[model samples]
Target: MPLLHIENLTHSFGATRALVGIDLKVERGEIVALMGANGAGKSTLVKILSGVLTADGGTIALKERPFAPKTPHEAAGAGIATVHQSTDIVGVPGLTVADALLLHRIAEHRTSLFVSRSGLRREAKALIDAAGFSLPLDRDFGELAAAERQLVAIARALADKADLLILDEPTASLSSEESQRLFDILRRLRAQGIAVLYISHRTADLQAIADRALVMRGGRIVASFSRPIDFSSAIQSMIGRRLDAVRPDARPVGNPVLEIRNGQLAATSVPFDLTVKQGEVVAITGPIGAGKSRLLSAIFGVGRFACGEMFLDGRPYRPRSPAEAIAAGVSMAAEDRHRSSLMPAGWPGHSLAATISLPHLTKWYRKGFLFGNRERREANRAISRFGIKASDPLASVWSLSGGNQQKAVIARWEAEPSRLLLLDEPFQGVDVGARREIVEAIRVRTDRATLIATSDPEEAYEVADRILTIDRHALLPTAADPTTNLAITGT
Candidate 1:
């Protein structure tokens, strides 16, 4: 019998129907993967199952018993827990490892307020050890790395005694090694008879851990398959068509467009040399803290190069700051769109307009206050061009879905023409339609020279004309050459 079951689930936001008549089931100890393009209702279903949002209509059952959790706390109480892709840990600086663990125990009411510190510490230690984490018991959780933060989230879910674990894009930012460690932990959890609902865009991770796969499109589950499924067929189902042909702009390589000669960032210990050409996409792949980010930052002028030189379009260009980089015909779409790219508090129209008319805005802001009417007009133009889903231009960015939020970020860069574009994880949480749109946009930008960095090998192979792997702070050419076989590897 299935451990959890859903039937005829439907949901919407205002007039927008986000999900329609969806059904799914997870058997005991099974790892089920939910695959779809961004905005395909995968997140909506997750929200319903995790009790973060109520469904408009549906029936849910667990162990053949009616199941309706009213709150996230209730969902945990009923043995379902979800770990979101974006880490949401707060107040960590004030809380010790033991305190964080005990807080979970307190949330579940497993112990009284007067619980002994020694007992809490002992239990916390056991959980940490069991999860293969080696943090000091008294250390603050805020000091831990990104992977450690994820492990802590998993530990908290385990503490709830959850029977089903829903992980959303858990490996998006992880390095190859950190990702392998996470897979190890998932295997351990599976061995303990825990069912997993895995959500991710990377086909490699899905193939590694999932027992069953469900492809969602247009707010519906359109296809389902058991294990040993073909990767190409699965992707085709998710995208609703074959994506075998290389993008038309992905032309044969030519002369270098941008060159980095013995570049070094003293603050980050990144020393590398590389080049990107017109009509070619080059990817930089490495593990977390491998200085891949720092390398991009240095190249894009977010950080200064302490030594070496950079040439853009055959002209010496060492930008002192991001503004200088933009002035030199370079733009970067950051990895953390919410914090780094989007203006969270600004009105959607204002943000879109600012990005679309950045070159003019930069000049206008220097002279005087921006004309509100003109700004809105430009912003509206960008919104329509990018097909951004929002009711009003004045809507706050926080009101949009994750995929739409990402699209807004892409629109910012796409509005202005540049000599070289640098994108970091451009499709992180984007849906299928949005992913296709973004990829097509990149393909179009190939005539303008583009470089993208991603952790997913399949994504790299899909979008890049050449794959460059970062190993020991050096860039090495991969087998993604036009004439060579595409052989992926970790260094």
Candidate 2:
């Protein structure tokens, strides 16, 4: 019998139906993959399963027993734990690894009284060591690197002793080595008879870890395959069709649009030199802690280089801040869009329009208010151009689906006539349809220079004109063919 089952799962946001008549089942000790293009209701289904969102019509059964969890807390009590794609830990900047894990346990227990901190710490230490990690228990989480942060999140979930664990794109930002470590943990969990529901866009990972695969589209299970399926066929099912093999375009290379010589990331010893020509799309891929983000941030001025000689369009240029990067005709769409890109409480229309034509709106800031009509006009134009799904220009950005939110951010940057575009994981949680739309928009900017960083090899092969790999804090070129999985190495 299946460990968990969903029947006739349907969900709608207002009049828009996000999911319709979806059915799925997971058995004990099974590693099942839920695959889909963005907007196919993959995230919605996961949300429903995790009790973060309620389904309008559906029945869920745990071990043939009717289960209707109203909140994440209720779901946890029922032995279901979810590690969401979006970071949701509170006071993450201050919490330590042990503290974070204990906090999650306390939350699951829902206790209002004092707990034994010593006992919690002892248990946390055992769990961390068992997971093959040696992180300093007293170090603040805010100081931890991205890979370390992810490990802590996973450790928290495992500490709950959950019978069913849901991992949503856990490897999206991780390097290959970090991902391998996670996969090892999953294997351990599987051996313990705990069921895992893994969601990811990286086909290579599915082949390595998943035993069964379920493809979701338009909020339904369109296809499923047992183990040993070909990777190409699995991708076809997830995308709902075959993708044309990407070939490098034969275009004349123009003068260098961006150049960095002996760039150092603050106090780090990792230094590299790189360049991008006009109209070229370069990709930087690497294992976790390989300094991919630092490189991009240094160039974009989020983290100023300690020492570097840089040139933009044949002129000396060194931006001290992100605003300076923008002023210099460079725009970057950061990986953490929820935290960095969107102004959650701000007006959506104004936010979308300001990304492209913002200097005009800045004049109104001094007047202490914005002209709604002007903001709406520009926002509406962007919404139509980018195909953002919302009822009105005034819709809250937080209310839009994840895919649409990503599009809104992309629309903001794409509207600008930028000289250099740095996009970090432009399609991280986006659905397939939106991915195509976003790619098309990027491709249309043939006159501008662009650099995209992604962990997914398929994304790099599909969108990049040239691929660069970061290995041991250095960048090296790789073949740009989509047919083969390129092995990134330090040269």
TM-score of each: 0.83, 0.88
Provide the lowest-lDDT 10-residue window in model 2. 482-491
Q: Which ten-residue region of model 1 has the weakest summed lDDT?
A: 482-491
TM match of model 2 to true structure: 0.88
Per-residue lDDT over 1-491 for candidate 2, one digit per residue giving the tens place of the 0 to 100 score: 89999899899988878889988899999999888876678788878878889989989998789888888888988989898876646327777667776775566565434756676667778878777665677788777765567777777777678889999888876767778888998999899999999988767788889999988877778888998856567667767678666544546668899988877665556677888889777878766666677778877888867777999998998888988888888888887776677764565433444433454445445676866776677678768877787777777776666777888787777654789999888887775556776777787677778888776667876777677887665676655444554333222
**Model 1 steric clash pairs:** 37-431, 37-432, 38-430, 38-431, 38-432
Error in Å for residue 129 of model 2: 2.2
Backbone clashes under 3 angstroms, per model:
5, 5
Off by over 4 Å in 2: 108-122, 134-136, 230-234, 237-239, 266-271, 345-360, 363-369, 373-387, 431-433, 477-491
lDDT of 1 by residue, 415-489 (tens): 666888888888887755567667776776556678777766656766766677875556665553454344332
Residue 407 local lDDT, model 2: 84
